[model samples]
Target chain A: MPGEDIVLRTEALQKSFGSLEVARSVSIELPRGARHALIGPNGAGKTTLINLITGQIRPDSGKIFLEGRDVTQMDVAGRVRHGVTRTFQINELFPNLTPLEAVTLAVCEREDLAGQFWRPLTAQKAAIDEAFDILTQLQLADVATRPTRTLSYGQKRLMEIALALATRPKVLLLDEPAAGVPKDESAMLFSVIAALPADMSVLFIEHDMSLVFKFSSQIVVLVGGGVLLQAEPDVVRRDPRVREVYLGQAGYV
Target chain B: MTTVSQAATDPHSWLRGQSRWSYFEIAFWVIALLPFYFFPTYLTLASQIAITALFAISVDLVLGYAGIITLGHAMFFGLGAYAAGLITKAGWGEPLTGLVFAGAFAALIGFLTSFIIVRVRHLALIMITLGLGFLTLELANAMSWLTGGADGLRGVDVWPIFGWFEFDLWGYTAYSYSLIVLFLGVVAARRIVHSAFGLSLRGVRENLTRMPAIGSPYRFHLQKIYTISAALAGVAGALLTQTTETVSLETLSFQRSADIVVMLILGGTGRLYGGIIGAIIFMVARDQLSGMNPQYWYFWIGLLLMAVILVMPNGILGGLSRLAGRRS
Candidate 1:
């Protein structure tokens, strides 16, 4: 913890959509190089919390900080510029673009490649190179040139993560990374997460108990839009409140 | 220094090193010089081709690049022609000034009209554009004093290009003038389509949500594409007025709007050359079929369109491109 910078920390975060309170006074911290997990019931506001962190939706009240810098008011893209990248719950890959093209475009956005339009897509060697590297790391090299629409659902999901990785963020947020993916492909994702850059911090929301236990070093539980418990994966799994709120006494917790 | 990452590690590195412009430039030159050596027997037909080709290309920019489906694009072209005709008849005299004014005027109308149009999508957008075109043409018909009513404007003098070329009513000057303007329009459209701004438009067309997720304001880019497309449509209109030396309220008719859509669809939507081919084939079919039987030509045209739609939903070039893609 001495060298860790607490890459992302949220203080008393509160969010409500109209009359629905989805996140309530949630306080959370992600260490400099920590792999943190947010676990909760189906409607525990985990997605809302991730959305607030990435500025996809504004918090009704509370603050989000990245690398000790306040990013409470930044828009989604602005947060991306500040090194926060997020993978959506549903795959958002460009359906017609190849995985390589998708990653290349993400690199273009990261490097401000919009102005290089007249220069030809081929001229941005460095950005393209970096994109390729990111795609390769995500195990997308095999389907690099295949249009995303042609890829299997698992590959499309992987491509979505590759796109987020292409931004080269200091803090990465994954929303249900293992949801809807094949078991084999889901395991591959864990391997990819384990292989990310040492300094990068990842905060993930997942419902898959196996994925959560395998990848998370720390876990925070949210029940009914509020923090239910925060502890190591094993401890949180055993917590009675987590059982009562998420497991409901005798079910999948 | 660029490090060569292994293909096993990253297969797309090859794409990172290739340029998309060199290929585009080569294709552009081939198309631009094509008409010069292949002028048909009648010069009037050639001139008509040039004008219609420019119009088609203009429509393609909005349809293909911006992903805007407009059936009323002729509104800008028709406005440009009528504005130029009226201003020149009022002693503006110079074709260049008339043309510039025409584009400016049409662009202004386009800007105002688009604010109401761009907020809608698909069928609603098409209907709004169609309605806007109809209303403009109707208004033009109602104001006969300036627009010559349903009779059409006549005797509008267009001075020669650069004061040296007198526009002859015959094929000679009209053909050459249209050829030059069409070439210029193609060059400009190509530059715009290949430009960085255009790339952003492509991005928006590909995925609207992804654009803002990457920090782009999609609405601003959409507006820019709309304005530029209108300006292109305006130039095509101005060229038509210059060649014909007359403007009819019919220029803005719903039929003309429908014709543009047919032309784009027949050629291809997003592919640049689709417009040119669509226009040429459409006009030639109209001319030949009408010669055979003027009264029944619409029947053949309708049948031909139906066939094209049923056989190739992407139009000719679009279908061919997909075929080539599959083979590749």
Candidate 2:
């Protein structure tokens, strides 16, 4: 496929921590609206790649393009304004704000209306309405008024997604969206992902192969801090290198 | 009960429910008209209450809503007082003009200090502010020719409000004027604390990481609050200088800063009006105890403060609100 339509591209990204190299000249193109799964074993630099793209940490040398815009030097908030948002592997919702309030805050931030502190919250009806709609879409309408501290692990993870969605981002970076989800909830989460808008892209890091195989349009296998291969799921399943690195670890021939 | 529900439905519910406004309004009318009947001793207590209350509310801008704890608030208070006193005694301006200049001077000090202050957190920030206060106080004392050093400024002629209400030597005009300014200051402060900016400030206080991630420049918001807070403290100090017609080196002392903190905590931090109630209670207690026995009074005051601190951790007003909430 032509890379011109790509929303996010990392060009030979490199990062190292003292003697340990986390990412070394890694490159990839995530096309617009592509449901791309980044599958890797532990210490395979999945999170490091996510951080580099999101500007949490600077790469030693690389160019990051988000929607035809270079965002390599943008600070965290600057990156957010550029439409790059990520949910933590560990859920990072505001502990004290209600789910609706947290999502409304995100929506407000995206609109650049956060500085207006004189207006009452109830006056921001349009923002609140949009936030509630996102919460309902994520099956969190019942818990919208509940403080995130009281939500179940599954709900908290879902709220994190809802929080990210409120930003109206074009590219959503979900770091292990199913990390702590129960089996039933995992299926529900996959279905929810399967039902998202065709124009919005999802790039997620996942360890669960079954869920990855079921939902991903394309799989990018990462092994030892670099792209091992990028291909269709069936091609990935047949590749010996992928088998040796991942399936071998789980002792499945 | 009816008014409570009405308050909930009102768009201005935040203003209506604020104890700071309610208690301040009540105290304003009572104290403003007190000179008509009360003894001169009572009026003196009222003037002290006005000054102390102004300081506490100014500190509340940072402490209660912005979640910053300052131990050197007296720096702004003392600076404002000294600046006003020096200006008036040197024949620069009238009472109101002196107060405004005092505010501007304090605002400059606050703006410069906030660059270093906003970067630190908690205990370290407190220590830095404390050191700043002490440094200013020493500087004022060392400049004895202008400030009167160990003594204080005499011959400070503040005149009167509007050039007609000449302040009676017994302070009739001074007490009424101070009470009026105190009332307006409290109302203005109430508006700010309940504003949308105030809500965001609370959000920042709740989580700094989340605030910036949602598109706020955390440092800018913090610095703005700090500067505004200091200016308000300056106004309070200038008001005191106007009332007493004197500025002493003690305005910048660490004890005065500590006293402001004690007033805020005693009324209950974060409970808007707690500052005013705390100030009134503290000043009244101090006045009564000191009048009864000048030597043994401080010991009794300390015991009383300890009792209030231990018994009502949320302070008098906070405890009362909680009780009211429970009953409902």
Per-residue alpha-carbon lDDT of model 2 for A1-253, expressed as tens digits? Answer: 5346898888999998997788878888888788889988888889998889887889999899887788898887787777777878987667766676677677766776555645655566677678778888998876666567888998888887887777777778889988979888888887887887887778888888898999998898887778889888999989998988865574321
lDDT of 1 by residue, A213-242 (tens): 889888988877888788898898788777
For candidate 1, report its TM-score: 0.85
Displacement of the residue A250 alpha carbon in candidate 1, Å? 9.0
Best by DockQ: 1
**Which lDDT tens digits does candidate 2 get at residues B1-328?**
5543453233233233432346645765675576647677567567778777888998988897788889899999998998888898788648888888998999999999999988899899899989999899999889999899889987788866777787676767777777777877776776666544565676677777666455556677788788888888998899888888888888999999998888888888876578888898888888878889888987976787788888888887777777887998
Worst 10 residues of 2 chain A by lDDT: A244-253
Mark the 10 consecutive residues where model 1 chain B has the least summed lDDT: B1-10
lDDT of 1 by residue, B200-296 (tens): 6676778876765665555666776677777778878888888888888778887888898888898888777788888888988988899999899
List per-prediction Cα lDDT, in the order shown. 0.78, 0.79
TM-score for the first chain in candidate 2 comes to: 0.95
Off by over 4 Å in 2: A1-3, A117-125, A132-154, A186-197, A247-253, B1-40, B168-172, B289-328
Lowest lDDT block of 10, candidate 1 chain A? A244-253
In model 2, residue pairs whose N, Cα or C atoms come closer than 3 Å (at least 3 residues apart or on different chains), thus clashing, are: A117-B196, A117-B197
